[model samples]
Target: MQAPELVERMLRGDRRAVARTISLVENAAPQLREIMAGLAPHTGRARIVGLTGSPGVGKSTSTNALVKALRARDESVAVLAVDPSSPFSGGALLGDRVRMQEHATDGGVFIRSMASRGHLGGLSWATPHALRVLDAAGFGVILVETVGVGQAEVDIARHADTTVVLCAPGMGDSVQAAKAGVLEIADIFVVNKADREGARVTARELRQMVGQVEHGPGEWKPPIVSTVAAKGEGIDELLGRLDEHHAHLTATGEADRRRFARAREEIEAIVMSTLRARLGDVHGHAALDKLADAVATGHGDPYSAADTLLAALDT
Candidate 1:
């Protein structure tokens, strides 16, 4: 279908169109410029939330439960599950979809699994574009479940309006979250598998850690919720906390600030990608090779070579 037709259909909530648009984004199709232009005006209406944690933390289970809670409230939801890439096919492992099969037949929920494709940040490099597709498709809320690649998962904070970090009892997740630097980025923390032993200890450690970080007056403090997600336990409380965080974001104008930063990051990424592509071209590569030779031989400084390359691109 033409870009305009695809955009029109997607905006009308056509599931096939939404899927096809995300495919185009993942492949970086030539039609994206037009498609994105057509969809841009309709974007920014969806609440984007990100869920991340270490493996075995029941991130998928919690996500499935959250989807149920959100749908019960009559909200339209889209789930973007970024999964570890398969070595042979470079596609998502599909584990997340398998776990979420209960929602497969629910028209109110849209679920997509994307392969991280070796992206180090727990997300596919195409994630931001795919998010735009979902947002323009009129999903009231979008849940971005990142590949549980500990440490590097902080990238989700840049893409999401609210970030939920999950921890499991006995996983040493509180210490891990602190080590991974996710504690600073989390808006809400979930101690999933709360029925397990050490659950209270995990929650206590989280609370103590949170208390240590002094927030300026009126600054939002991350709240920890305990959940045994496999049984749908504590999901309503989790949803309530999510609502509170969203309200806090809007009331304090943090939502606008976050969105502005997200847009700026997106734009900067595109510019960097364009530059890298151009630098891979034959002429630019040749220039870089010559500059590298000069630098190795002490004939030119690295700074001067970089300036020359940038000058070449401008011309």
Candidate 2:
């Protein structure tokens, strides 16, 4: 199908169209620019929630429980699970679609597993564009589940309106979360597997850590919610906290600010990628090779070589 027609179907909430469009974005298909352009007008409506944590932190389980809770409240939800890529095939290794099988038959729920494809920061590079597709598809909420690669996963904060960082007991996850710099980015923290031993201690440590942050009287404080996601315990409370955070953002006009920042970052990323591609094309013409040889032979400094490459782009 043509990009325009595909975008039309996507805006009408056609799941197949959404999937196909996302695939095009992932593969960098030739029609991607047209598809994104067509979808732009319909974007920016969905609430984006990013979930990140260390490995074995029950992110997938918590995500599944959260989906059920949201569905019960009559909300249409879309989940974008960013899984690690297979070194051989560059496809999702830990497919969240398999983990979230219960939601497969639900018309109101859309789940997609995207390979991170060696992108750092726990998310696929295509995430921002895929989000545009989901937002345009009329979903009330969009959940982004990262690959959970510890500290670097903090990138989710820039993409999500609300960031939920998960940690479980007995894995030193609390300390790791602190070291990972997730403490600063989390809007809501979940101690999943709350029924396990030491869960309260984990919660207490998080509370203490959160208490140390100085905030204005009206500033939103990150809430640490305990959950046994496997059993669906505390899912309601987690959802409640998310709702409270969203309300705070809306009432304070922070939502608009966040969305605006997200757009700015997205635009900047696209521009950088375009420039890098153009640089590669210039390199193919041997302009870069000569510069590299000059630098290697100590005939020119690296800085001057870089300038020459940039200057070549102008010609």
Candidate 3:
């Protein structure tokens, strides 16, 4: 089907259409621009929640539990599980989808696994666009699960409305989060596998860590919620906290501000990518190579060469 027809079908809640659009985005197909333009007007309705952390923190399990909780409240949900790329096929490893298979048959739930494709920061480069497709497809809540790459996974904070960083007992996650600056990006922290030993210690350390940061008056404090996701424990409280955070964002007008920032980042990313591609075009590359040779031989400074390149692009 054509891009416009596919978008219309997606907006009408056709799962197949949604899947096809996402695939187009993931592959960076030639028709992507048309598809995004068609879906643009229907976007911005879904709540984008990001889940991230180190491996073995129960991110997948917590995500599944959270889906059940949302469904119980009659919310239609879509999950974008970003997994590591398979070295051979350059496709998603599919581990997360396998773990979340319980919801596969639910009409209200749509689950897709996207390969990170060597993109750092734990997300596929196509994630934001895929999210737009899902939002336009009429899902009320979209959960984005990032690849569990320690430290570098904090990029989701820019794309998600509510960023939930998960940790587990004895994992040294709190220390890692502090070092990686994930603590500052988190809007909520979940200590999953709470039934395990050292659960309270983990919670206490997180609270203490959060307390060390200074916040302006009325700033939303990230709450530390505990959960045993495998047994579905504390899922209700987790959902409640997410709802409370959403309400806070709306009440404080931060929701609009956050979304605006997200759009700005997306636009900037696209522009940079386009510029890079333009720089690598045949004619541009010939000029770039001469400039590089000049710089390497000390005939020109790097900054001047960069400026010249930019000036050429302007013409």
Q: Quick one: ranking by lDDT, best first?
A: 1, 2, 3
Off by over 4 Å in 3: 84-91, 96-100, 118-125, 149-152, 282-315
Predicted structure 1: lDDT:
0.84
lDDT of the candidates, in the order given: 0.84, 0.84, 0.83
Mark the 10 consecutive residues where model 2 has the least summed lDDT. Answer: 116-125
Candidate 2 lDDT, 1-315, residue by residue in tens? 998899889989999999898888767687988988888888888999999988799888888898999999999999988654342463553465475577778889998876645343322347788888899999999999886655346667888999999989898879767877887899999999999999999999999999998978999999999999999999999999999999999999999999998888778777777777788887785887788899999999999989988887899
Q: Could you estimate the TM-score for every candidate?
A: 0.88, 0.91, 0.88
In model 1, where is the ten-residue run with the lowest total lDDT?
116-125
Error of 1 at 18 (Å): 0.5
Clashing pairs in model 3, backbone N/Cα/C closer than 3 A? none
Model 1 spans > 4 angstroms off: 84-93, 96-100, 118-125, 149-151, 282-315
Question: Which sequence of candidate numbers ranks them by TM-score, best first?
Answer: 2, 1, 3
Residue 175, model 3, lDDT: 71
**Local error of candidate 2 at residue 135 (angstroms):** 0.3
